[model samples]
Target: MGGWFRENILDAGKLPTLLALASFVLTFLITRTVTRLIRAGRGPFRNITPGGMHIHHVVPGVVLMVVGGFGAVGSGRYGVAASVCAVVFGIGAGLVLDEFALIVHIHDVYWSEEGRQSVEVVILATALASLVLSGFSPLGVDTLSPDEREDRVTVVATLVVNFLLVLITLAKGKLRMALIGVLVPFVAVFGAVRLARPGSLWARRFYRGRHRARARAALRSYRHDRRWDRPRRRLQDLIGGAPDRAD
Candidate 1:
């Protein structure tokens, strides 16, 4: 275990990143627990309200993000200082993402169904970080040989090709695929070659007046949702707690 950490983490100069990832996940989990407790009114935990105005966690998160971000910028990427900065940044990210739905909706809805968006965003963020930690470099740069990397034209070409593929995947309305594809180009290729979602820009531009294609795309989307929606919701509920029932 130590050997693996030395080789994969230390040698790769990813100790700070690893530390940050750990802190990020732990912070999110802890924050969720406290918030849930407060919501249930089953523990001593309670919301932070001053002068009858609720103060959300995102406030401190932004502060940490600023401090850690600037600290990281000044300290480079190594040593104890960098590690500390990474942890701080990770905590900030966790707090901010935990309230992502509030940010997007511009209102407080932490216990409502809309709040599940925060869970989804955090899951996506975690998955992206995990992929990076697992040795997937942006735009598949890690896939290139040393020789290819030395050749500027080859490196530029590879990056451009991968970027276009990711863009196409995004345009096709496969947001998750496009995001993952930024790390794994093959995933982007899969998304790029697939049919666009019914209301996606790609579909609207290309599938216009094509009734059959629209029907097929809609049907595929519906089937895909049917297959994954329940499992996805269950996983979200398990991790972030279920939404509150409306009176």
Candidate 2:
């Protein structure tokens, strides 16, 4: 079984590997661009001709592009392992960007309760429209460079997938959604590293450490909440004519 798997899977990683690499490059570039723009004191989409833009909209599209590309390119490289990694990365991407995802969902959550959904709705709509356009074609830019078309397509696909993922979470909130939020980016990189270096036990150890950090963060939050409760109760008692120490 090991021999057959090795012969078939390990040897068939070239295309998927390339796709995964492409995803990594695209994601890194997009993330960096957004970060740089934010740091430059320039609001996102400032240079657009007329319609304006939300720079944050790039993340989801990048995530989805990677997911689709990796899945298609590496479907056979590691059997079920590849599929699992893809799902993990896809869900993780969805979860990590749950904030942006929530921007759209807030409308659903407070459809009648709030009035400021207009701005969020507008930004999100623009992003979704951009995704649709880019996913189907490059749209406006000159066609001098093939790489430009590929980049545009990847960005659009990523946005669509991530946006769809947000829709799914809004429709179905559960443990599965939470898990995906935490795992997509992690699993994509994890799977890629693992594929690139099957013998690296250190990678596995590093993931374990990450889990431990999450556990610690939860504990800290719980403690902080408990501390707040005691103080609130004391303040309420004092307000009701009971003596309470200032310290």
Candidate 3:
């Protein structure tokens, strides 16, 4: 185990990233737990409010992100100092992402239905990090032959093609698949080839004036939601507390 750790993580210079991913996940879980307790009035935890103005954790998180990001950049040496900076960045990211919905809406919607966006982003970030940890290189670079990698044009073309696929996947509204596709382009290709979700930008543009295509896309999306939405929401709720009903 130690040998694998040293060879794959330490020697490969991925120690800082590993530390960051660990810190990010741990900090998010801890933050959620604390917030849940506060919500339930079951612990000593309470929201931070000063002078009748609530100070969100994201404020400090932004500060830490700036400090850690610069520290990592300037350190230039991936040793103990670099690892510390990585942890700081991870903690800051967790805090900031926890309030992503509020940032987007410019209002406190932490417990509202819109709050699910935060959970979704965090999950996507975690999954993307995990894919990297698992040795998946972005843009299908790892799949190329050594000769192909040595060719500048081949590398650039591969990246461009994969990026286009990711963009199409995103347009189709398969955000999770689009994110994963950065690490594994095959997933993006699949999403791009599939029918777009109803009301997605792709469907809005391409399916316009094509009633059959629009109906098919809508039906497929409805079926998909029926099959997956509940369990997906349950999983999200399992990690982050369920969002409250709309007011």
TM-scores of all models? 0.96, 0.26, 0.97
- What is candidate 2's TM-score against the reference? 0.26
lDDT of each: 0.92, 0.40, 0.91
lDDT tens string, model 3, 58-166?
8998998888889888775468899999899999999999999999999998988888889989998998998898799989899989999899999999999999999
Q: Which runs of model 3 end up more than 4 angstroms from their true locations?
A: none
User: Could you tell me how far off, in angstroms, the CA of residue 54 lies in candidate 2 after the best superposition?
Assistant: 4.3
The deviation in Å at residue 43 for candidate 3 is 1.5
- For model 1, where is the 10-residue window of minimal lDDT? 69-78
Candidate 1 wrongly placed segments (more than 4 Å): none
Point out where model 2 deviates above 4 Å: 1-9, 12-22, 25-30, 42-49, 53-56, 59-221, 224-247
| Residue-wise C-alpha lDDT for candidate 2, range 1-247, written one tens digit per residue | 9876545435644333433433433443354354345545566534323356443433455566477557656666556666555444434343233233235554332112231232233233334333332322222133226675579676566545544443333333222232332224332223332211111243233434576654554565467568875775454233222222335
RMSD of each: 1.2, 21.1, 1.2
lDDT of 1 by residue, 46-102 (tens): 888999999999999999988888887887777889999999999999999999999
Instruction: Rank the candidate models, highest TM-score first.
Output: 3, 1, 2
Superior by lDDT: candidate 2 or candidate 3? 3
**Candidate 3, pairs of clashing residues:** none
How many clashes in candidate 2? 9
**RMSD of model 2 against the true structure:** 21.1
